[model samples]
Target: MKATQALTTALKAELRRAGITYAQLAVHLDLAESSVKRIFSRGELTLARIDQVLALLQLDFVDLAREVAQATPARQALSAEQEAAVVADPHLLLVAICVQAHWTAAQILETYAITHAQLVAALTVLDRLGFIELRAHNRYRLKVDQTFRWRPDGPVMAFFRQHAVPDYFEGGFDGPGEQLALVHGQIAHARAADFHDRLQRLAQDFVHQHVADQVRPAGDKTAYTLVLGMRSWLFEPFRTLLRMPGAAPGIAPRAQARR
Candidate 1:
């Protein structure tokens, strides 16, 4: 339940979802499978090793942190309501946000104000839970896939569905109605799942052709990260409008502008 543990759990799920097995991941990192297993068992990771794994996987620490920060709107608000929710334990909130963005611990601790012992403790919990796997040298990266599904009664599932989304939309929009529409109206769950699956395949292919092609097998160190996912239909209208030539390059007025 510690922040570091939460992060590790998120990382493990992401790695799994990406189809990167422990053995395969060990090969990617140039480490032995047994070493990898031992590191995770101990839940101890050094910052440098963490970096190498993330690099091999084409994930950036800073970008992932920023993505996490941006994904949680509640963290960005300045009002009293926001203050109460976000300030409770910025560290924990930051961890949650990072998990959402699929970031590494190095990314989370860069701006973190907690003590080393606290950070290590958090990471240990995460490692023990199989949320992350440690490198031979004690650095950690996500072991699960980013899109890994949480059990129906898992804390993460409950937290996101119950707290994160509701808090995000509080006083900002029609909540229940919008939720209903999303769950029942525009796109069904099955269709969305299929779309996501296809999207992942496309992303994998793109990375293999474009990003991976640029890297040599001799540890060339050149890499690019590919984030593959779909946005909701809420942006469909804008996406369609943008395709029109000479469309002013911005959002068109809701009423098509006063002629």
Candidate 2:
């Protein structure tokens, strides 16, 4: 069933690549455009219909199967070990983050202090880790799915908490195209969960838009980060003052202060 869906998706992509619209496809297949669209949408095309469509598109079942095989799977979250490997080397972590942000090799080298050799070495490690497939001339293919995520309490987040978070907070968010909001309110648990879901959707939209805009001229692009988060907590001082009378002593929180 999953393979059927994958094949349907690949076929649709091939149709677009071949400039075959639903109207054209319908004309060729002797079906209405709506019917053709429904067949693709539901992945319910009969073998005969599938062959007819493929013939119209000049593709065979083998070709479609190959495309399905090559289609990138949606990556969820990396394993703890993978996250630890990234965190263990700061330079490697930098390269990993750049790739996540859709930075190309030229862009990375132009923006950062990494040398060609260093960048190649980092890409090689990522290839070994299955994060990417290294190609000729230091080019590589991103293996990360659109849904890829860092583990919530993983090493990557720990690094961010230790370093990036502090630097990010230092920003005034007062520049053009920048704004910050700090909202504190009581809410039902269900409502909080709903808000988190919305934030996740927004993050996905941001990522998709970034990928879509890669075709634009580099000069027309600007780097941006959309950080979304939520937590039920309070600053230590506020929590201390709100402690109930005669409650147990407050414990010191572990500090993530840099050495």
Candidate 3:
């Protein structure tokens, strides 16, 4: 990320972590709340303005840099070793996922069977893993950014694909706050890349919404998993029915960028 972008991102996260609303920040900066929101969204703040925000947040440039570094460890990619560590302990993995989702320690304790000590232990593991910076009273900020993703082929993804995916899909789609859409179409192989970008963007939108709704009461929020997928394939049974089995889209190679 560009320096300005990284700084802005870190600034926004600091504000969120501090529970400083845009309205609150606007009062600090002597700007309209709309302008503050725009500055955050578009990252249009100048250096002097960023300094002003930093002063308001009681953070210096070094603090901002540290936040940026923490937010983007390994370019926001986990090592195979790190993934293995997280997947090794089921509880640790659960805690990692919850913390990444911005769940509070109390929420995790209330929602799950984990004891406070167990939760603190899990949090200490995360702190060592650099996924979070443990703070006094168990209040912490996520070290990872909103756009962070687990390795596509890592142990965590493998575990989810083998276990969580099945459970996730078993849910009936006909319910409130639920959707399942399957669309198939043919386009030039090159045009398919466009959809890939859109799916990535949509996934990002979900994370952005998650961040925005953090201010909502924990009881008002529900855990949600978004699965976005696209591919050209004929079912095995349908493949047998296809008179022209030699011709099928997505069979060759997909020009997908790494997430």
All models: lDDT?
Answer: 0.47, 0.76, 0.79
Among the numbered candidates, top TM-score falls to 3
lDDT of 2 by residue, 1-259 (tens): 4977987887776665444688889999999999988999999977898899888866668767766776767567778999899889878999998887767789889989989989999999998888876655665556777678899899999889898887976777777666677666667778777887887787789888886676567788777777776776566677678658445343322211211
* lDDT for position 75 in model 2: 61
Candidate 1 lDDT by residue in tens digits, 89-208: 545445544543444455456656766566565555545544444433324554445344344344444555666555543432333322211221345657767766776676546434
Which runs of model 2 end up more than 4 angstroms from their true locations?
1-67, 70-72, 243-259
What's model 1's TM-score?
Answer: 0.34
User: How do all the candidates rank in terms of lDDT, highest first?
Assistant: 3, 2, 1
Q: Candidate 1, which ten residues in sequence have the lowest lDDT sum?
A: 250-259
> What's the lDDT for residue 28 in model 1?
74
**Candidate 3, which segments miss by more than 4 Å at Cα?**
1-12, 22-65, 68-74, 242-247, 251-259
**Superior by lDDT: candidate 1 or candidate 2:** 2
Task: Looking at model 2, report the run of 10 residues with the lowest lDDT sum.
Answer: 250-259
Report the lDDT tens digits of candidate 3 across residue range 1-259: 9988988888877788665789988998999999998988898989899899888876678778876776544337678999899999989999999988877788789889988988999999988888888876786667777668899889999999999877877777666577776665667778788878887898788888887888877688776778876667766786787667766545422322111
Q: After superposition, how far is residue 68 of candidate 1 from its true place, in Å?
A: 29
Residue 187, model 2: Cα distance from true site in angstroms: 1.3
